[model samples]
Target: KANNTLKEIAEILMASRSVLLFTHINMDGDTLGSSVALCIALRKLGKQAHILIEDDVAAFLRFLDKGYCTYDNHIIENPDICLCIDCGDVDRFRERKEKFFEGKQKGCIDHHVTTEPFADFNFIDPTASATGEIIYELLKELPVEVDKDIASAIFAAITTDTGNFQYSNTTKRTHLIAAELWDYGVDYNEISVELYQNNRLEKLLLQTKILEQITVFAGGEAAICGVTQEMLEETEGRMEETEGMVETLRDISGIELAIFVKEVSREKCKVSMRSKKYINVAEISQKLNGGGHARAAGCTVMKSYEDTKQEMMRLAEEYLKG
Candidate 1:
């Protein structure tokens, strides 16, 4: 549960002279866009802000300020406040946990159901479509100017996480906020081009192979695909290249649920889930010690791909049958 209100969190952020933002391990558009937008706004308020992101950021998101993405060592000095944006679990920012705790005022701004308000101040609103939506409101409280740069970042955050406004999580408020971003001159076309249209040939090849290996289950209501390190090596594709692979399965005519299993290591796998209608993939992810929205969710399992896939399929079968 969150203990602090948005205005309260904004007051703390406004009072702070320096801030450090943490993004999740696998830097996605929501986390990156929210953090970058907040950082940019904070700088406009004459505060020192930096976003500590994993070096493995996807190429598509590089349009955001790369200068802000840095480590504690890279910065001239540590910040007074540390905040994690859109990250539901502390483990997501484990690499920077120490530096995060070192801040005088620790905070979290997110829109995830499982976030527990671990920081000194927190604003976790599962009702919000994305953390970017929360950040957009936070900016109004801080009363910082929203420029084109900030607009685009937040736009990407909301757009990507909401699956370009196609996911069940998107609401009237989401569209209203998006329209406001357009008023602020956010380049929606550019964001779309970078996020969806821009693709590497190797990634396409890798996705083709994964699609060919799809396993259907739940009487064609569900499908699953496994991506191994060998497959990446074989296709000369990076792990990040498989970003939308799960959606491909869900898009099939008869499929209501889709799963993408990425073998992170020999004994560990990262899974993404998407649902068309009835299935609540978030509940499914929670069963695997993960959390997300009703239709889209993800988890990392510390088991072999075969074991993990088997368990996920069993769970999928159970949920579908119920």
Candidate 2:
């Protein structure tokens, strides 16, 4: 039933002299945090390790140390292994896919339910609440000290991915791992403040704007909203500020499905979906050529925002009837 060989993966990492970690395009907390922790662990073993993230870290997460997770690979010249952390699809590499494959070896460690093996070696554990848990296990196999920095990174990854142990994917094992990481002196209090309490006023206004004009349909079982370029310009908000806005829609009473669309361009829109009770948003996303977990999923639609919104409403109506 296990989809990974932790010992074998550990051996592969140990043998490598230089390691490069690749995070996904959007650069979520799970990918960035997991990669940072793993990179630190590799370095503690006296090997050269660096994290490669093509996109800029969001303003909220910029407080994290940049030396471990960097925008450029200035130190890593020729990596012995390139590992993708919390990256489900090759598309996540975006412009950096070539750098990922350039290493002598490649591997993937992920927790997304839709992910499959796409590297030379893969440890795909959908049961894990976050890839950080897998990295924690792998670190236990390596001969390195679990210092405060590593613990803080892993804690951030697990907490964010699990919604601070609020999401359905969180398991008993998650709490146990978190408890153990606490022993290593993780600065969890600071992480919580950065993640939840440090929202900018512009972001607050933008979220308020989204909720004020949400569209309800399918007999009020579904709610939808959008972030247009015009809206961002008006509120002085960035696209990354809209990360958790869809969850607010799902939290509304009587809402079973929530959809948030962000205008990518004049003829393209990005869609994020979240379901509270029974609807499988992942199924809907796959139908639209995207994939994710049951409760959460996303897709990119090649159509005008209005057209994409209408299509999502139609799908929500159809799915709500079940």
Candidate 3:
């Protein structure tokens, strides 16, 4: 996989004149930060680079480049190449997929285990903690210089995804890469607080409301919560604020699995799932047209809240049984 990805990266970089980069919808720090890091790397190489994110970035990450969160497709017309960061599959690109692939060259760099290697050049390592780790490796391979800004971008990506080197996915390589980044002047404390701390007033209020309804099942073996559209609208919190709140439910005492469902629109619900052991939530995510890792995964369910919640519960029950 490394050899194939390296050859593809070299070919794609050599062939393209301008490059367009993108990541998944409702992107996290890993997705947003990695995309920007790659864009900066390309620009440093004297290539025309742009990042096309799918939706509004989380408030916490607005500090990077206040204007870097969104892009227009008119600007994406007939590019020389398109690179995807932290996105696993084509479908995750949504409407942008057509315009993205319309470029002369296409590539994807991701860290999801379930990804099917769908790109002209693909570098996907499930063993890696985050796509940021892959970008760091790419920097080493291409001899790109890492400045403070680039280091912060890559550092935010890795630390956020690995839960500050605390999650089970945290590996020796993750720590070593982080050590190298620290050498580039990344402030671990500030970035951690910025990424995981500093919740907005409305976001904290939203979490408090959700916590009221959080429920545990089977003697604290499973945890679940639901957030309705009305609730979000009332709290002045967008879908982005729901990112880490799901884990609060997952981390309950003795809980092996956790599920958080939020109304995306009238007919769609975003489902975030996390597990401690012996559960593959990514498999569950794939069933609903989304994916992540064994411990953390997400999917959008298309149905009424009642029906969607029922379906998600059924799947979680089956996973527990298995």
Candidate 4:
């Protein structure tokens, strides 16, 4: 029944005169690839379609051609549909939410459990590993065939989100989809190198600096670390370099939780929390206005790192104690 609903969504889109797709801020590969795949698919269906590119440059995804996706307001010359994918809520739309939805038809496809599904037509599957996975399923529902480009894009989306099939979210279904993409001639090794191994040397230096700041709390039961713009500048690394460093702290023999507080700017801090066992970082992240999977989640903090770190630890400690 759920898959039927997503098929209805594809059918509705196929009939639309025009459509625009958007994803969360600081677009990652999964969001970018999924948005692009949907845009390409919609266009192939003989509809005017385009992907809205975020103004913020996601360092990890900088290798993608900037011009591949269009971000012009002129595409909305005629009132049509707007599609939001991977993103959970309107807030994740950043500055363009108002313009994207204002006086325009709305549709959504997402895989976030916390998503409120704010679209005229919505298809959300929280169990899916990534939005790209849902997109692949939707394409299967469509009578149209999946081409090489569409296959590659969806493959990129799922691979990145599942950490190249390393994360716990990677299920047998994910592997099956991966096998199909491989049959479609997707180069898994090249994509992995470009997406994950292309980090700059500065990011490595920053990782060293960050590792030096690792703090083990309550006898290694909890760990915390932070990075500032100044620290990033000193290491000549962009904020993206801090990607999986926090999880490294979780590697400690007895640490159950690892927290990384990154100062995105003067007042905004990007807080990423991860746990291995019983600690529910999701609950702690929600208290700070963030959301993600049970083991991994994040929120943005508008306060100083000191205050934010303290409050997060305080809230997290409660879970640890319980």
The parts of candidate 2 lying over 4 Å away from their true place are: 73-78
- Residue by residue across 35-108, what tens digits does model 2's lDDT show? 98998888889888888878889876776655887667655776799898896787878877778878899899
What would the TM-scores of all predictions be?
0.96, 0.95, 0.94, 0.92
Can you write out model 4's per-residue Cα lDDT over 241-271, one digit (the tens) per residue?
7777877887787888999998877777888
**lDDT (tens digit, per residue) of candidate 3 on 62-101:** 7665344456876757888888789867777887988877
- TM-score computed on alpha carbons, candidate 2: 0.95
> What is the C-alpha local distance difference test score of each model?
0.88, 0.87, 0.81, 0.78
Candidate 4, position 299, lDDT: 92
Clashing pairs in 4: none
Q: Is candidate 1 or candidate 2 better by lDDT?
A: 1
- TM-score winner between candidates 3 and 4: 3
TM-score of model 3 vs. true structure: 0.94
Best by lDDT: 1
Ranked candidates (lDDT, high to low): 1, 2, 3, 4
By TM-score: ranked, best first: 1, 2, 3, 4
Q: After superposition, how far is residue 198 of candidate 4 from its true place, in Å?
A: 1.2
Best of the two (2, 4) by TM-score: 2
Off by over 4 Å in 1: 73-78
